[model samples]
Target: MADNEFQSFLTELRRGSLTLAVLGCLQESYYGYGLLQAMREKLIDIEANTLYPLLRRLESQGLLLSQWDTSESRPRKYYEISEKGRLVYKELLAEWRKMQSSIDSICGEGEEDERFN
Candidate 1:
């Protein structure tokens, strides 16, 4: 595949996983920039543009809770996962593990077949 095509495939693969990652990270409260920095620290390459909209969407979906803190010179909106979000995150994690196990099994089978050939 062309470089752009490979990038497109990679982006699609990261989409769902990104949601799970965001939900997992928001177990603690973080403002937009803080959350972005934290995710980057963990080697998750998410753009600010993508993260903001997703935060809004998750908040709107009742999967997250947001509060504004004005103690500092500037006010920032902080987000944390709700109880519902924790439940959903657990479910998604389970599903991801199951999918990963199946993929691993298939790849192991492929390796075995290669050894026979």
Candidate 2:
């Protein structure tokens, strides 16, 4: 693929995972940058600007809860998944497993593809 096309494809890939990553990461409380770091540690590869805005939006939607904490000298907002968010996460996880099983049945080779995407 051309550079621009590859970048666009990558953007598209990230688009689908943003919500899943948010739900998955917020199993523990995290500030925006901490969430970015946690997602990166899990190989989600997201940016802070993108994640912070998403956290705010999800909080507003009641899927997440946030609080401002000043224990570290500078105040930062920490986010955690709400009860509704956990329910959504469980549903999404079930759907994801079903999809993965369907896809796995269609592929006869390459274990890494099954492991990664």
Highest-scoring model, TM-score: 1
- Candidate 1 — what's its lDDT? 0.96
Name the best candidate (by lDDT).
1
Instruction: Give a tens-digit lDDT track for model 2, residues 1-105.
Output: 799999999898767568877988899999989888888898887888888888898889899999999888899999999999999888988888787788777
lDDT of candidate 1 over 1-117, digit per residue (tens): 799999999999999999999999999999999999999999999999999999999999999999999999999999999999999999999999999889878787578668889
TM-scores for the candidates: 0.89, 0.84
Error of 2 at 76 (Å): 0.7
Native-to-model Cα distance after best TM-score fit, residue 32 in candidate 1, in Å: 0.5
Model 2: which ten-residue window has the lowest total lDDT? Answer: 104-113
Q: Give the TM-score of candidate 2.
A: 0.84
Off by over 4 Å in 1: 109-117
lDDT of each: 0.96, 0.86
Q: Once all C-alphas are superposed, what RMSD does model 1 give against the true structure?
A: 4.2
